[model samples]
Target: MKLLRLVLPGLTMIAVTYGLARFSFGLLLPDIKESLGMSEAVSGIISSLFYFAYCVMIVLSTVITTREGPRRMILLAGASAFLGLLVMAVTPNVWVLAVGVFLAGASTGLASPPYGAAISLWMSRAEQGKGNTWINSGTSFGIALSGAGAILLSPYWRVTYGIYAVLALLALLWNFRVIPRAEKRWKVTFEKGNLSLKGIKGANSLITASLILGISTAAFWTFSRSFIEIAGDYRSWELSGFWVVIGIFGVLGGFSGSLIEKYGLAFAYKLGSLSIASASILISIAPEKWLVSFASAGLFGGAYIFLTGVLLVWGIRVFIKNASLGIGIPFLLLAVGQVIGSSLAGLFIGAWGYAPAFILYGFIGIAAVFIGPKKNKAED
Candidate 1:
């Protein structure tokens, strides 16, 4: 019961911020483009705004949450989501839509770090990893919900976004009721010379791997549905179903902490990286085939969330002193990678097309495997 209060709202907040607010842009891009007369290149540039906003807010949230406690930051995140979704619902032009995307993306950045801190503050140490991963999986739930909305509201994207805004508001209200006021503020002092590279293990590998994975996954998150719709000439239901499959399979990622507890982070990291990379290559092979596309979506969803879960644990362990920083660092770098990858993906798809672009990203993921955490003998 104690854990339920935090985890439930935690998950929902993440779902609203990440799934609906951030990734859903890709799922709905084709329609949005048709409505706004936007090109793929322009769409990609706008999508990059999501990450840029996220990057700024996450850094600020990490610092603020550390000093002020999680309550205000969490509420701020919810508020951002609500406003962003509302803006998106009414957006008439590309500029207004970009503002909405920026705000929505900012919500995700505000959402993540504080939750990490909240888990550290509220849950027992033993329960922190499980709680964090469960909350992280909320992205899958939000994605699935958005996919369902797409099915029911096909070609009525404005209505779909309006409904999502109401949902975000509801989530915000729920969190406001549940989240407690600030307790003890965490103290972080760089001037004390307490933080150093030698003290934090795995920081380098974690940041590098996260950035690479971010770049590798950006093509999919930003353009996979478009690929399927255009390349496969999939119907509305089929495309929506593909997005749903990704979310449903992504729930499997919630178990990543357990996987690490049993098989260790090294194993989880390697397996997840390979699986996600394979997903990109797999879809490229036969996106026109429904089975292949859905399978690839499932694989990507599961693997992407799973890898993030692994990173959450890895980041927490690396920055054991500051849990918010633990969550902030890897995620911040991931957004940085997305910022770069989103832009490059647009150009690549424009120049070389989807297949070659996706294949190239897959190779990037493969390269990430070499830079992963060293296998711990004790955990192995």
Candidate 2:
């Protein structure tokens, strides 16, 4: 019962942050663009800004988690999500919308690190990996729920976002009740010129792996549905179904921890990198094929979530003493990579068209399989 209580709140909190706050933007953008007379160029810039906010918050979150601890930071993450959604629900202009997007994006950054701490602090050693991955899978739940709501609540972006705010508010309340409070704040000082990679082993490899994976995944997340819709001529609801399948299979990604427990991080990471790259290749080659489309969605969704789970465990393993930064730095690098890759993908699509651009990204994913040293071992 104690473990269940912690998992539910963590799951819902992640759903709100990753699913509602982050990915739903892509889903809602068509309506938002139509309503606001936005251009692709401008929207891309806004998207980059969203990632920029995510990157900044993730960097700051590590510091805050170090000084204040994870419980307090988690609450702040939920609050940021609520405020962001509320702003989006009522925003009358693009600038305001951008503000909302940034805050919402930051929530994902803020959400990640603390949970690492939470699990390390609360869950037993045997249970921790599963709990962390299970919580991570919450993003799938949020995405699926949003897709369903989008189908049912057609053409009401504001209402959709408003509901997201209310759900976030409830999630905030639930998390507040379940997540314990921080003890008195502590202060730590870092020298100006020198950096501290103290207590974190294999930081370089982790950053490298995360950055490569992030770049590879960016093209698909930002533009795959667009290609399927435009090139494949999918009916609107079919696209919704596409997203639904992704989320559903992503939930299945909770098994990543099981895979890691049985096989280990190197095996899991290699499998995920190959699977994710294959997903891109699968979709890019046959965007119009219904069978392939759904299969690609499933593969990408499961593999994407699985790979992030691998990272989470890997981070915790290496940065054993600093669990929050363990999670934060790798994820932050991934986000930073996304910021660069997503931006580059936008330009690449303009010049090269979707198939070639996607194929290039897929190749990069394949390369990611060999990023680090021969071993790719996680510290015990």
Candidate 3:
């Protein structure tokens, strides 16, 4: 029961950080671009800036959380998010929105590492996969809600931002009330570790996997709405439906803790890599609307989250001494890939069209299979 209590709060934190702070961009992108009078390429660049800040802050966040404890970090994260939303709601210019998103991304970055670490500390090694999945599931749920809600509340972006700000504020209060503070000496222990070069090989492999994953994932995420708009000849409703479908499958992906547990991380990673490649190809070639959209969403959503879960667990297991750094390294690389993909998406779409870009992303996914870590006796 106590464990369940802990899990709920952690999950809530993930939902707020990921769903509201991060994933909401997908839902609100069209509105934001229209309202700000920005081109698609510029909009993508703005969104990429958020990820850029997020990537830089990951390591710093890990250090702070390790030293100060997750409770304090959560509070700080919530505060930053609230401030960012406030800026977005009221700011008069695109540059200001970029600054707001950067702050918001950094704030959310602080929550993830400590939250993952804290959850790991609370759960036994045998149950880590399930525990992490439950927390991540919150993100899926939040994405579903935010996407659907934003569409339903369209033409009211400012109001939506206000509501999201309120959510973050509430999360801050909850964190203060529910999470316990750490001892003063936790900082000392957190700082005592000596950096080593031993994890470089594993980190490199993880970074490669992350980059491929990001390219594949970003292509879908950044372009899904546009794709639907063009292919389905539909509006916000279809895009919302797609997100809802993805979230449903995303929940299933989260519950796939057993798959990771039984088959091991390598198997899960390979499955995700293959699924992403296959899905991208199918989405690229399919002429039928329902088949293309639903299949694309379900397959990509499931595979992406599954791979994320697998890689995160694998990082913690393989680099136990510096698990936070291990996780942060891959995430940073992933963010870079997202920025690159987003920046180029408009160019590719305008020049060659969606099918070609989708095909290219599919190849990237296929490459991930080869870049992934091979089975080794030592790895085992």
Candidate 4:
């Protein structure tokens, strides 16, 4: 029961940081672009800036959470998210919007590492993996909430964001009350920096795979809703429903820890990555087919979260000495690849078209499955 209590706040934290702060940008991109008088390429650049900030903060989070011990930084994550969304809600121009994007992006990075440390400190070995992954599934929860909001709010994007900001503020309060404060030394001392990741087996394979997966998923997150809206000529409610299906099904990914215990971790990773790639192809080619498009969203949402869970476990195994380092390294690299992918994908789409870009990214996701660890590995 106590363990369950700890997990809830972490879950809410992820929901706010990833779902509201980061992913909502994609969901609301059409409204935002129209209101700001921005082009797709510019939207892509802003999205890339979000990932760039994410990559940077996730790296810094590794060090800060190590020294600060999660609580303060977790507060920072929530605060940044709330303030970021508030700014985005009120922003009158593109430049101010970018500032909000960067801060909101950073919130996800800040939210991630602390929760792992918190769970590690609170949960038993039997509970740790499940708790962590369930919290990770909060991304889906946030998505669901945002989707519901979009449906109800309709054409009011700014009003939608303002509500999201209130959600973040509530999340902040809940987490502040729940997560324990750091010890005296935890506040003052810096984590001892080794500046080395020597002798970690399969490190290369893990990072390579993360970067590959990141690049592949970038286009989907950045443009899926807008693409669907354009390609299928979907109504606002239809798009909202599509987003909700993804979120509802994505909740299943929380069980990935159990899946790993039943099947091998490597098998789970391959299956999830493959499913994600297939999702892009399925929807991209058949946008006019309502059933196929919805199914694709559902598949991609579940697979994306499941794959991320796999990466979280994989990272911790490779860097067992520090939970923050483990989570940060894989996620940070993934964001780096996203920064690259997000920066360029709009150009590709503009030059060719959306379907071709999705097909291209889907193939890249397929390629990710083969970048497996070189050695025969035991299940973690």
Candidate 5:
């Protein structure tokens, strides 16, 4: 019970930070754009700024996580996120809002690596899958909560931002109180060279898979609510309900970490990726059907995040010496793909409609299967 208490707070902090930092932007984007008199393209770019900063901060986050350890990094991240959210709450213009988003992204970037590192450190090897899942589920929960909160408090996005700010502050406090600082210290080493394409070896497959996953997942996440709105059959709360259902299933999926241990990361990844591809197709073709969208959300949320946990574990195992750096590389690639996908989504939806856009995303997932590593049966 005592151990569970210590771990639960850390997991909650990660979930809250990720939920607000990444998923909330999509949930709140439509309202924010409308209030600011911006077009969908401009809105997409503004939201993409978060990912831009996130990608840039991955290197810094990796360094910090390696140096100071996960606990302190998380505290700093929470503080940064709090300030960023406050800035967004007070901003009067779109440009200012973009700056706020950038800061928020940087805060999350700082928080995520350390949080992931901390989970890896604290959880038993057998429990790592479930631990990571719980941490990741915070993002999904945040998304659902923010969406529901926005609908309940319509036309007052500032209030939602204020709520996020307060949550971040609480996370910061809890982290400092509960998470013990790392005692081990090691000399931080960087290769006497620039961060180039060549610095990363045998990481191509990971990066490629991450990019595909990012593009497809971001497309679904950013537009899922909007898709429901445009389909003209569901209430706003109903759309939010779908996300809430996804969040519930997400928690169930995340707690199945032990299952991944038995099945192997590669097998789990393949299954999750295939599930996402199928779910995307169903949701796209049957946009007006509530059950289809609801089922799709559950499957996609569960499978995508479950796969992420698997991949992170695999990366850590593959690059034990530079585990954080290895993890950051794939995240960086994921961020780049998300930015590209989100930026293009509005144009694609306008030109080709949601079905085609979803089809494109599904194809990206299918492409990932080929790019992933293929070792012999003996290697497994």
Candidate 6:
């Protein structure tokens, strides 16, 4: 019962911030580009802003959540999402749109670390991992909702974003009512936030793995739908259906906690990376094929969420003393990599095409597998 109370609202919050605010842009990008007269290069540069904002906010959120407690950061996250979505709904120019995207992305950065801190403070040790993974799966739910919205709203993307804004506002209120009050305040200090080299010992593998995965997955998140649309000439319904499939399968990632507990983090991590990498390669082979494309979306969505869940637990264990930093550091690196990857993928696609770009990214994901987690009994 207690778990449900936290996980439900937490999940909703994540869905709103990540799924609606951060990722829905990708699903809507084709329309947005058509409306705004954007080139692929311009779109990719704008998309990279999302990760750039995330990179900035994650560090700040980690430090603030560590010092002031989770409640404030959580509320701030919801507010950021609400405002960002509203801006997206009304943007008149690409610059305005970029501002909206940055705000929305910042919400995701703000949303994650506080939840890690919250779970640490409110939930028992046995339930913390479960709480983290379940809440993380909210991204999938949000994505599914956005896809459904895209199907129904079709070319009326402003209306879609407007509706999403209202939903974000509602989610913000829901979280405000549900998230626990800050119980205590810690003295703010540089060391307390765990940003030091000493704080990151034995975490080299986690850092490397997350950075690489971020780069590998950026193409899928930013351009996979565009690839399929161009290659297959898919109808509106089919394209949205592809997104819905990704979200539906991504719900499986909520079970990542169980997978990690049963099989161990190393095993689960490797499995997820392999599956995600394979998704990229598989789609590159025949993105025009309905089965192949949809399968790739499902594989990417499921494995992406599952791998992040594992990283969440892995980060928490590595920085056990500071839960916010545990979530922040890995996520920050992920965003950093994405910031680099989004622009590069855009250039690569323009230079070569989707297939080669995706294949190259797939090899990168496989490389991440070689930098596996160390044998840590405490984490196990």
Candidate 2 vs candidate 3: which has greater lDDT?
A: 2
Expressed as tens digits, the lDDT of each residue in 98-185 for candidate 6 is 8899999899999999998888887877898899999999999998888898888868889989998898889889988887676543
> What is the TM-score of candidate 5?
0.87
Can you give the lDDT of residue 153 in candidate 4? Answer: 75
lDDT of each: 0.87, 0.84, 0.71, 0.83, 0.70, 0.87
Worst 10 residues of 1 by lDDT: 186-195
Runs of candidate 1 exceeding 4 Å displacement = 36-42, 184-199, 377-380
User: Which of 1 and 2 is the better model by lDDT?
Assistant: 1
1-380 per-residue lDDT for model 2 (tens digits): 25677888999999999998888888888899999899988887777767888888988887888666678889989999999999999999999999999999999988998888777776677887888888989989888888787777659999999999999999999998888766432232211122268545688888898999999999888888888988877788889888878888999888989988897778788889999999988888889988998999999999988888888888878777777877888899888788778889979999998888988998999999886323444453
Q: Spell out the clash pairs found in candidate 4.
A: none
Q: Which stretches of candidate 3 lie over 4 Å from their true place?
A: 39-42, 184-201, 376-380
Candidates in order: C-alpha RMSD to true structure: 3.0, 3.4, 2.9, 3.1, 3.6, 2.8
The true-versus-predicted C-alpha distance at residue 223 of model 1, in Å, is: 2.5
Q: List candidate 4 stretches off by more than 4 Å.
A: 39-42, 184-195, 373-379
lDDT score for candidate 2 against the true structure: 0.84
Q: TM-score of every model?
A: 0.92, 0.93, 0.89, 0.91, 0.87, 0.93
Candidate 1 residues 288-307, lDDT tens each? 99999999999999999999
Positional deviation of residue 321's Cα in model 4 after best superposition, in angstroms: 1.3
Worst 10 residues of 4 by lDDT: 184-193
Off by over 4 Å in 5: 1-6, 39-42, 120-123, 184-202, 373-380
For model 6, what is the alpha-carbon lDDT of residue 135?
A: 96
Tens-digit per-residue lDDT, 101-217, candidate 3: 887787767766665665554456566667766766667776777877776776788788888888888877877776666652322133314345473547667777888778777
Q: Model 1's lDDT to the true fold?
A: 0.87
Model 4 RMSD, rounded to 1 decimal: 3.1
